[model samples]
Target: MGWLKMPLREGVAALQNSIVSELQRNWPALVTLTPDLLGLEYPGETTLDFLEAIRDLTDSGMVTCEAIIISSNDGPRMVDAALTARGRAMFEPKGRAAA
Candidate 1:
């Protein structure tokens, strides 16, 4: 059980890292937070998993989400997000590393 849990945790962490890195690379673009959009950005990741990663990023304050009503049938939902200052800093080259 413990071994199974370890792999699962590692996989999730990897997915999260991938999502963050992709967002950082695509900085300044208003990325839709939907599973389909994320899947397009990161294929091989299930919609549920991508949604979970987006939730984690939002909770961590690394991104800002905006609610939008897409249609009459659909209610207002968090549809788009953009990286925050902290997230942008992630890609900044370090003092010596930049040289």
Candidate 2:
């Protein structure tokens, strides 16, 4: 199963895209380290669904964000599960599992 995660946004505009896209566009530096996500404030794209477009890339192993492309010190980052829940595996509620 894919790792479920989300970026810590301060307001509405930052949370525009899903978390997956954030991983791909900012790569090589930000990296797909698994269980350790790079955090950064996300910017908006004019011609793309930044999050939905590359949702599957992260599961393949690696994904990057555009922010990491230009800078060495990136901020908060978003993740895939919060993006669209496309590859997430769900089970019964935790409380019910013990029953």
Candidate 3:
């Protein structure tokens, strides 16, 4: 998929902002890909992209995501903040078949 490219450092920040919190733990429960259940347009894709980008930050002690969850007051929304070795973050959408 076409993604907005940036830098590794930015990817790290993006992942942290998207998943990591001030829990002060070595590992996280899971990436917990946030989703809008109401079904928006690109929120889910944007969130999943970050989840896929996890490959980029794995070496940096970043946490990995498990199952993706979708939820939205108005529409289902899920966004990924996974990091990519290409030194950037991306939005990896779930398979269209599942949609």
Off by over 4 Å in 1: 1-10, 40-45, 68-78, 91-99
Task: Candidate 2: list runs displaced more than 4 Å.
Answer: 1-28, 31-48, 64-99
Candidate 1 per-residue lDDT over residues 1-88, each given as its tens digit? 3333212333556666766666666667776554444343323345445555666666667777675333334322345667777665
Structural similarity to truth (TM-score) of each candidate? 0.54, 0.20, 0.29
Q: Candidate 3 residues 6-50, lDDT tens each?
A: 554434455544443321121222123332221224454545444
- Using lDDT, give the best candidate's number: 1
- In candidate 3, stretches whose alpha carbon ends up further than 4 angstroms from where it belongs are 1-6, 9-12, 22-31, 35-49, 65-99
User: Residue 17: error of model 1 in Å?
Assistant: 2.5
**Over the stretch 11-64, how does candidate 2's per-residue lDDT look in tens digits?**
322323334344324422344322123232334332123333333334433333
Q: Rank the candidates by lDDT, best first.
A: 1, 3, 2
lDDT of each: 0.55, 0.32, 0.36
Q: Between the candidate structures 2 and 3, which one is better when assessed by lDDT?
A: 3
Considering every candidate listed, which one attains the maximal TM-score?
1
The weakest ten consecutive residues by lDDT in model 2 span 83-92
Cα error, residue 24 of model 1, in Å, equals 2.3
